[model samples]
Each structure stands twice: as C-alpha cells, then as structure tokens.
Target: MDKIRIKNLELFAKHGVFPEENALGQKFLVSADLYTDIRPAGLTDDLNASIDYGMVCHKIKDFLEQHTFRLLETAAEKLAWSLLTEIAGLKKVTLEIQKPWAPVGLPLETVSVRITRGWHTVYIALGSNLGEKETYLRNAVESLNQADGCRVEEVSEFLVTEPYGYTEQDDFLNGCLCLRTLLTPEELLALLHKLEQEAERKREIRWGPRTLDLDIIFYDDLVMDSRDLQIPHGDMQNRDFVLRPLAQIAPYVRHPILKKTVGGMLADLEHSQKI
Candidate 1:
C-alpha cells in the first residue's frame, strides 16, 4: 500500500465541551494519511485512477465546520467514517484532530485525538430450515445490501443440506455471501441479530430450528474468542455445509488461525468423512 499525506490542515470549527466554545468556535488542525495503491494513477498519469488529496482536504474542512460535537473523539470518529464512506478509492485512513486552544490550566501545546478506520472483507453464512427457506436466504442477502456501511459483494448458489446440530428438522437452504463493511465485528453481529429477529427467529432451543440463521464465517482474517462472537466461525472447518458454500465464493481465502484455505479445509473435511 502507498501513502498520501496531508498535514497541519487548519480549520475553524465549533467542537468543544464548553458552551461558549461552541458559540465562538476554535482553531483545529487535522492531518491524514490515506493508504491505497497509486500505481494506476501513476502509470497512466490519470487523476481518476487515484484519490485526490486536495478534494479530501476540502471535505475535511467542510465536515468539521458543519458539525458541532463536544468531544474530539466523536469528531475524529465521525470524520474517519465519513471519509471512508465518501471517498471512492481510499482503502484506509489515519486521522489526527488537534485542538490548540484548550481550556486546561496547563501549558501544554495541544490536545489531539488520532484514529484509524477502514473497510473490511467478511464472509457470512446464511441458513434456514423452516418456511420458504430460499426466500429467507435471498432476503438476508438483500437486507445486508440495504444496511448502511455494508456492501454485498458476491453470493454463492444455495445448497440444500441436512441440519448440523439437532438434525431432526427438514433440510436447509444454505449459502455464503461476501461483504464489504465498515462495522466492527461486534457491530456486525448486532445487526445480524436484529435481522434474525425480523425473521421471527427463536432462541428457545440451542442449535434448534430457526427461521433464519446468519453466522459470520470469517472477518478479514481476524481471530477472536470473545464471549459474544468467534471468528472463523468455531466449527466452519468441520462443517461441510459452511465450507461447501464458502469454498464456492472464496476457495482461496485462508483461515488466519488454521493456516488453511477454504477449499483445502473442505477437501480435508470430505476426506475425513470418507475414512
């Protein structure tokens, strides 16, 4: 990745905790490092092939001047998200917002908040065994596409497969879809739960029948083991249902933890079943 740097871009904005601060406004300095591949623009001498730092500077000034927030943290966070959402070719951004006129009694030069944000590639598995299964799968994909900060990149063909855990129910319509999202894993999981509830999913029985099941199979090679979520989906390597569909879309996407590609895992799982 290459870098485009913008430094010490000063602007007057009303962003502070004090009431008078908001009314009078204050001077702030913002700097950003944008990460992207500039090869196309460099080789072709075309500005359209890369991001424009001049335009980004203007946007930052406008956004800061238009919005009023109490915390620089809030301002920086929202600004980072705005840049990531609005900028077409920007891959990652590191932003620093500096406030020089602080009310603190100390003689410090300045106070600033620095943050980084970017889009992540995620693979999600969709499954439903009850009532109009394929519709549920398609609806899930549509819902993900409609959600803010999420773009559905590709979807695998649906497969009819038997249940995984408690296998007494009818077969399920299973598939996987690739997503580009700005949300963190936890935020993504929350949104999925909301979608499931919209589908009238029941949680009374563990691994029991459900109207919709959405699982995050992979999140940008992230490895996590928090109470609420697990990356690489816990059992994706062992489940033919998940790997079969995921392999179709991202056969070469490697599991960060296991050091195996999706296709390789599917092959191993199938071979083990034969034995």
Candidate 2:
C-alpha cells in the first residue's frame, strides 16, 4: 500500500475532562497516514486516483469541531472510523490525536492517543433448514447488507444440502456471502449470533435444524482458535456446501492456517471423492 501522510494539522476544539478545559478550548494536533494504491495516481497524473490530503485534513478538523469528546482516545477512534467511511480510495488509516496544553501541573510535552484501523474481508457461510428456508437466508443477507460498517459484496447461489447431523429434518438451503467490514472478528461473530437470535434460532441439538444459521468461515486470512469462535471455520474445507458457494466469490482466497486457496481446497475435495 502507498502512503499519504498529513502531519500535525492543528485544530481548536473543546475536548477535555475538565469543565474549564472545555470552556476555554485548546489546541489539538492531528496526524494521519492514508493507505491506498498510489501507482495509478502517479502514472496517470490523476488527482481522482488518490485521496486528497488537504480535503481529508479539513474533514477531520470539521468532525472534531462538530463533536465533543472528553477523551483523546474517543476522538482518535471516531476520526479513524469517519475517514474510512467517508473517504473514497482509502484502504486504511493510522491516526494520532495530541493534546499539548494539558492542565497537569507537572511538565509534559504532550498527551496523545494513536490507533490504526482498516477494512477487513470476511467470508460467511449461511444456512437454514427450518420453515421458509430460502426466505430465512434472503432475509439474513438483507439484514447484513443493512448493517453498519459492513458491505455485502457478493452472495453465492443457494444450494440444498442434506442435514449434517443426526436429525432427519428438511434439507438445508446453504450459501455463502463475501463482505467488507470494519467490525473486528469478535464483533462480527456477535452480530451474526444476534441475527440468528432474531430469526428465533434454537440450540437444542448440535447441527440441528434451525430457522437460520450463520457462521464466520474466514476473516482476512486470520487464523484464530478460541473456545467460542474459530476462523477459517474448523470444517470448511471438508464441507461441499460451504466450499461450493465460497468458491463462487473468493475461490482464490488463501486460508491463513491451511495455506491453501479455496479453489485448491475444492479441487482437493473433488479429487478425494473420485478416489
């Protein structure tokens, strides 16, 4: 990624823990690194191909002046998110919010909070075996599309698959979705669970039939293992229902742990079936 840097742009804002500090206002220094592809802009000599640092600076200043926060942490976080959301061609951002004139009696150069934030690519496997299966899946997709900080980029065609567990229930409508999101893996998982609950999903049996099922299959090549969640989902490579749809959107997405592309995994699965 190429870098566009804006350093120590000053702003006058009323952000502070103390009442006097808020009333009196103070100087806040902001610095940001915009991450994106600059090759096209350089070669084409096109301003539209890259982000304008001047415009971004003005936007940041406006956002800070428009909102009041007591903590620099809050300010930095909000600014980072806003930049990612509002600025086009911006892939990631590193932001620093500095408070140079703190009311501390001791001598200090400055107090600051810094953070890096970016968009993440995520693959989700969706299924429903209960009533109105297609409706459940469609509604789930729509719901995700409407979510904040998330964009539903592509959805694979639904496939009817036999139940994975002991239940002799109806066949499941299964598919996958590719999304770009600002939510962390854990946050995305929580949101999926919430969507399941909204669909009145029950957990009486393992892999049991349900109104809806949503699982996080991949998150930006991340490999994680925890009691509550797992990335590159534990059984994705072996599941045709998951692989088929996932391949439609991201066949070349490499698994961080397995070190195999989705297409490679699917090919391996097909070969195994022949043997």
Candidate 3:
C-alpha cells in the first residue's frame, strides 16, 4: 500500500549479448519501487520495522555484478524475484533495468525491461477418495510447502465428507489450504496438475474418484472466467465440503464477486437447506 522509491541507481556490470561487450563491461541504471506497509516504522520510528533502502541498493548492485546474462529481460526478471524473495516486509516490487549504450546503429535513448512481481494469496481445496486419503492430503500440503516461491501458511482440519458429484464413489477426505506464492495463477495451476499426475490421478470420469484432487478455490480475490480455470471456484459457495474447511482457516475471507465471507456463505447455505 505504501511506496518506497529507489530511482536510477547506476551500476557497472558485465552483462551483454556480444562477447566484446561482456569482456569490457557496461554501465546500467536500475530503478525500483518497493511496496509495503511502512506505517509501523513511521509511527514508531523503528528502523527494524521497515526495509532499509541502502541495503536493497547494495544487494541489487551485488546481484548484477555477480551474475552474467545475455538479455535484459532475464536480468530484470531475476532481479525482481531476488528482491521479492530477499527483502523483508516487501509486498510487491517494480524493477526497471536500463541499458543506455546499445549496439544498435540508431541513436536511441535507452533500452530497458520493466516488470512487477509480488506475492499472491491463494486458497486451495484439497481432497482424496482413494489410497490413504489423509496421507495423500498431508503429502500434497508438504509438497506445496516444499515448493519454491510458494509457502503454505495455514491448513484446515481435514473433514470426511460424502462424495459430491456422484454418490457411487467413496467418501472424500477434504480440507482447505491458505498459501502465499510468487507464482502466477496459471503457474500455480500447472504445479497443482503436476502434483496430481505424480499421485497417479485418473481423469476417466468427471469428478471421478482420484488419488488426490487439488483445486484452486480462490486466488487473491480475483474473479476470472476462462476455459481452463475459474477463480472463486464456480461451485465453492454451494459446496459445504469446501466452505466448511475454508471457513476454519479463513472465516472472514470475502468473495470478491459475492462480497460475502466464507463463514457467511456457509451460514447462508445452512439456512437455505433448512428452509
């Protein structure tokens, strides 16, 4: 929410496509905007409460000098990720890497790459109906926690519930997980699919029994409609299995489109069922 700007910090580094350019080294200018909550630091006048700009600049300089990349895009991406991963109390970062002296014959001002990187809050619903369901769920959580750029913050207690889509299959062990990650929604989806495949998940029938089922229930309050995925999972509000566990971890997590908390949604479902 708050901004700490570091503008046009110059660095001399050996980063270029040409062999001669790499050998000789070049001058590059970097600009970054660090986003975080600085209220505590400002109010208490505590240095420890906030990130030190000097340290950030030094870290960036060192990173540039230590690594050699042929493309500015690669450098910018790595720098942005490094800052987000290394910096404390950082919510998001916008980094720009500028290379002024280009080999292009035209007299251009500068060539640069700019990108925004941040941590996203995602809610995942995990379930399994076959082959040690509890172990499958726990292992899935463990795998996600061990993943790079992803952190499992909270997990709801697993609940044993009857199958939802088809009554023929075994009852599923279901739960919810709260995660903070640097991966985009698409990337996260891919990782989930990979984990499922590793568990030998079969897709012969829609909502069929599986070794493990991990679904993206919500992603940072994002409301998305795509052929492959949908955010605020289309049927989550109506599914007691999903809301029951999700409410345990995030009772107050509001649905972006419905503007109702998970607890409220669960209550509404209960009320409707009774009537």
Preferred candidate (lDDT higher): 1 or 3: 1
| Candidate 1 stretches greater than 4 Å from native | none
Specify the poorest-scoring 10-residue window by lDDT in model 1.
Answer: 162-171
Off by more than 4 A, model 2? none
Q: List the residue pairs that clash in candidate 1.
A: none
Q: Write the per-residue lDDT of candidate 2 for residues 171-232, one digit (tens) a residue.
A: 88999999989999989999999999999999998988899999999998788898899887
TM-score of model 3 vs. true structure: 0.97
TM-score winner: 1
Question: Order of all candidates by lDDT, from best down to worst?
Answer: 1, 3, 2
Alpha carbon lDDT of each predicted model: 0.94, 0.92, 0.94
Candidate 1's residue-wise lDDT over 112-173, tens digit each? Answer: 99999999999999999999888888999999999988999999999989888887778888
lDDT of 3 at 247: 96
Clashing pairs in 2: none
Taking all chains together, each candidate's TM-score versus the true structure is: 0.98, 0.97, 0.97
Residue 186 of model 2: what lDDT? 87
* lDDT digits (tens) for residues 1-275 of candidate 3: 99999999999998889997788888999999999999999999998999999999999999999999999999998988888888889999999999999788899999989999999999999999999999999999999999988899999999999898888999999999999999989899999999999999999999889999999999997988888899989999999999999999999999999999999999999999899
